[model samples]
Target: MSNANKHMPFPELTANEVSNLWSSFLMNSMQQRLLEYFLASTDDSKIKQIIEKILTQSQENINELKEIFDKENLNAPQGFTEKDVRIDGIKIFSDTFILNFCFDLTHLSISTYPIALSECTRNDIREHFQRNIAFTVKIQDEIVELMLSLGVYLKPPQVAIDSEVELADSFMYLNGFFGGSRPLNAAEIANLSRIIHRAQFSKMIFVTFSKLAKTKDLKQHFGKGRDGIEKVLNSLKEVLDKENIPISASGDYLISNVEASPFSDKLMLFFVNTCLGIFCFTMVNQAMTSSLRTDVVSKLGKISDDMKKFYGSGLLLAIKEKWFEQPPQAVDRKV
Candidate 1:
């Protein structure tokens, strides 16, 4: 360490800062290890460059987080390891799928890191999160640019109407139950695009995980989840395809029907749970609201509820297998 960098005056990290950093360290560790496999499997030079750039940034974040943990006298998280990734395993996803995975994860980070940043108070912590957010935005732009150049990019379909539907009367908008069930607006349409794309990705990813799970029960669970998510995807697609809106991240041509266990059951289950949370949040905040079409609102609400139930079951499974990592919690005042 440089003497100048080592000797900077820094305050003790708040509990929030410490907890956030701990969680990020574990997540970045998992991503970095996953990228190792992806980088090895990709044959395309352009895709390799993008993955390598992202992976390099991931590694730097991992190191910086470890240094903070060490300095704070906190035990570094075990996170994932060589065992978490099957080094000599068969290639599970095609290069196209790999690129989309990167894009999806990066897109997700855009929403997640800012939430963490909101709670941060320390200057160093805030600065670190700001930098992380900036880097993520860059990666997102690069992925989109490359996808567009590759001609595989899924753009949201353009909406066309002969005339502006004047909100001339109170009957134009409707609640979830009664009257004024109107067609989707631009915002609602955009949210549907987001929801549909996520559902499609989840189905394909879980289907692969279902086939690759080491245990029969987990396999069945993943398969069932995949099937259930497929219904939701279809419903979402019906909304879009009926209107002829282009769907982005269509998982149709990406993943191959492979026979290999590329990821551990624990890793795959955790991934499912994390995405479930993101989907639920997106649906409620963006899809289910005042003025959305009655049927669309109900559909989004039902799917969000199903995801919550699925998350609960997954939590139980994770607990039983001792795979769920408990985050830091405040001390009980009663204790």
Candidate 2:
């Protein structure tokens, strides 16, 4: 590699480019580590099955990345390195910390996929990203469910959809609020000022949740997530306002007729809700960066506390409901 700009270059990546490159790298990194771990296992059938399944998926994604790199004439990084396999020596058991780490990484990839698709320039790339996003989500849900079955506290999200049909529509409309409006024409951009606030408020909820999430073991590690998002939200808010768009205040999560899952499934519900929370946060970050709005960012920071409190309460309530498992019997201690 050329010494100029060395490993980390300053080239600006579209959201798609950034995620594609990162996911490709991560898949390669994960595959290598997983293979090593499996080889070290005592030839257990269950472990082998899990290893083969994940390795197969990684190979598929690797092939896809190669195709994208070749078509785009982008330089793909070299093969995976020893350093990439930092966790190779670690065992990934159903209830172990390594399993949590792997699942968290999967969540990161899935959460960012939609953002990248929304930000990418080319239609083909966007479509590819969208497909990958869906695949990743399915994989994530499966992984979480597996963990839950193993008695890991990590639960699958249970958004109570009436029917698949109803769920589809609810997801579309609700997600759209954060996904942002269609790409703006110059004239349309000029007229869409008020919508900026809606974006800001959405961003506010995202950043606040990012900050509030517990960072200890088995939790999502966003790494300066709040600051990074605020920067992006401010940029978008500023640009929209500069263009005389009526930068509206931040909007709320658009609730639909879709019912909330019952308290019995609180654990799984939290898993899904947390993932959605992260998605909303990322979209806000992307939109803010794309729009270059300072005012929106500022407002986002100001209002994030309220949003955090709102969502935080939801998470706590979910946990509280879980505490009712088997109706807690009081132990009688006779001295």
Candidate 3:
């Protein structure tokens, strides 16, 4: 064979794939401290029960990650000091601030889960990560529902899709993606990672709302959203890993107090989260295409509407809370 015709080997990364690995390691370290702070601050019984349940889940995930690293001969990096994440912008002492902090972390998780899933080659690993994504979505939906029950509403986004056409096209495209050899290229892998990251940040906003929401319904809505995003992230990860491009530390976000703020009540929290979800949905919508992975695109489009509804519900609740200055244009409804 001609030298030019010879197949080239995939590029090997000596360090972890993403640059933000160190940041993530550090952030996870800080989560323990944050959890401790939350345990001491809230006295509400229902909220306490939910917190405990989540804490257990978080602990298990950490252990599982550590085991994965050990089996792979990978060394986990020591994370950043609290000072690295500490921001003066959001007053840490306020209830709203604490809630916002949790939201940020959860949102980030939503983003990272898919990227990691994209890198895995095995079905078992993909399924495991997908479950994690679902858990996150469930948590986010719960948070939103809880906020709504408390009279806090987050406004949903205005999505523009021909309902009938989109529904039919989406399902048809999804079949194509599942039937084919999942496409893999450096650009495609990067795009998938971007979609996951966008979703994660969006979820962080919902987590923040959960902390501040007064009722069970808003909280439930946010939690459910987390579950859905988690599944998408997991699927993305599976495809990416099969293609041999796993996202690592390089793709994470840098959170400071600027993005942190206390929600005075469920309404305030929903308002913030709605904005975050819209931003994320836009990115997901843009990155998702019928060309590369039709199944993924269709799935993403459906989820985009799901999130939009969450945002819309939050907005309506905000109006009920007497919190709406003026409602944005009504969002497109999907069947």
Candidate 4:
């Protein structure tokens, strides 16, 4: 054994680095399958070019993630295979639907990549995720421009302006759990509005997937997620309503029953769980800052907890069915 090698500082991948690698790998894999199918059916040359670019980036990431896992002597789990998607099968989603999905997908990546970048300690790891952030920003901007130009962009409702800036008068603004508290801040309002929109999106996803899912177990899981997310949305909206803040409009109710599976049950379930994971990440970030208000912290915390428990159950099912991919971790040396 090399003595100097053993004494190296931070030689192995940190937990944050491992997670960043694992999540990026899994998401890239899933996106690859979806993008391939979209590209096969896309007739518009512009949309096909965008899809191809994303797929190329994903392939580059997949190769790099494999390298990272190999260096760590970890098994890079095979998430979904060709069985999960039928690339030449019936085109289940419309071109518009495909474009909108890509738009949201890139935006989600843009929002979460910074959290991964922040927790990275190794130079190589930081650079990898930083590239991810940059690439996603580029793609997200293009998607937004396309949506806006096509008049298909869904915008948040306009909030009435205060017109004048006001200074903080007291710390009572932070109180809410036990006593009087000031009105919601700009951050809290924005957070709540975002929550509502995402909840609506999740609800629509569940409704469509539940009907399309061929298995009873998967159907039940989708139904429960639909109910759970709706509950969280209403709870958060109550707080905003109490503050007399107007909530933003919900996402479009444009999804119709496909009556057949375009994607496997495994894929849709995993997709739902992925969204729940993002919601948890976002909720903690927003709620901790909103804690200055009374009752808001506790309410949001409970919702996050409930979401974890719900997602945990579905994750177990995915694992049992061999649909969930195990993420990379440090080597166990007990042998």
Against the true structure, whose TM-score is highest? 1
Q: Residue by residue across 1-335, what tens digits does model 4's lDDT show?
A: 25664466546888877887888888888888878888997777777887998989988989988997898887786867788887876666666667777876785687678888999987667888888889998988887787677666766535665768888787776677655676676666767777776776667777778888998988998899888888988898888777777765543445545556767888777777775467555755676666557577777778778887888888898888887666654468886
> Candidate 1 has what TM-score?
0.89
- Tens digit of lDDT per residue, candidate 3, span 177-231? 5455433433455566767655555555455455545557666766766666677
Query: Using Cα atoms with residue i matched to residue i, what is each candidate's TM-score against the true structure?
Result: 0.89, 0.38, 0.41, 0.82
Clashing pairs in 4: 174-292, 176-294, 177-294
Residue 263 in model 1: shift from native, Å?
A: 1.7
Please state the error at residue 329 of candidate 1 in Å. Answer: 2.2
lDDT of each: 0.77, 0.45, 0.52, 0.76
- For model 2, the stretches where C-alpha displacement exceeds 4 angstroms are 1-19, 26-48, 82-95, 121-123, 155-335
Error of 3 at 306 (Å): 2.0
For candidate 4, the lDDT comes to 0.76
Candidate ordering by TM-score (highest first): 1, 4, 3, 2
Count clashes in each candidate, considering only residues at least 3 apart in sequence or on different chains. 0, 22, 76, 3
Q: Which 10 consecutive residues of model 1 have the lowest summed lDDT?
A: 171-180
Poorest lDDT segment (10 consecutive residues) of candidate 4: 248-257
- Model 2, span 147-250: residue lDDT tens: 56656542222222333332323333222224452323333343234233333433433343343334331123222333444554565555454444444343
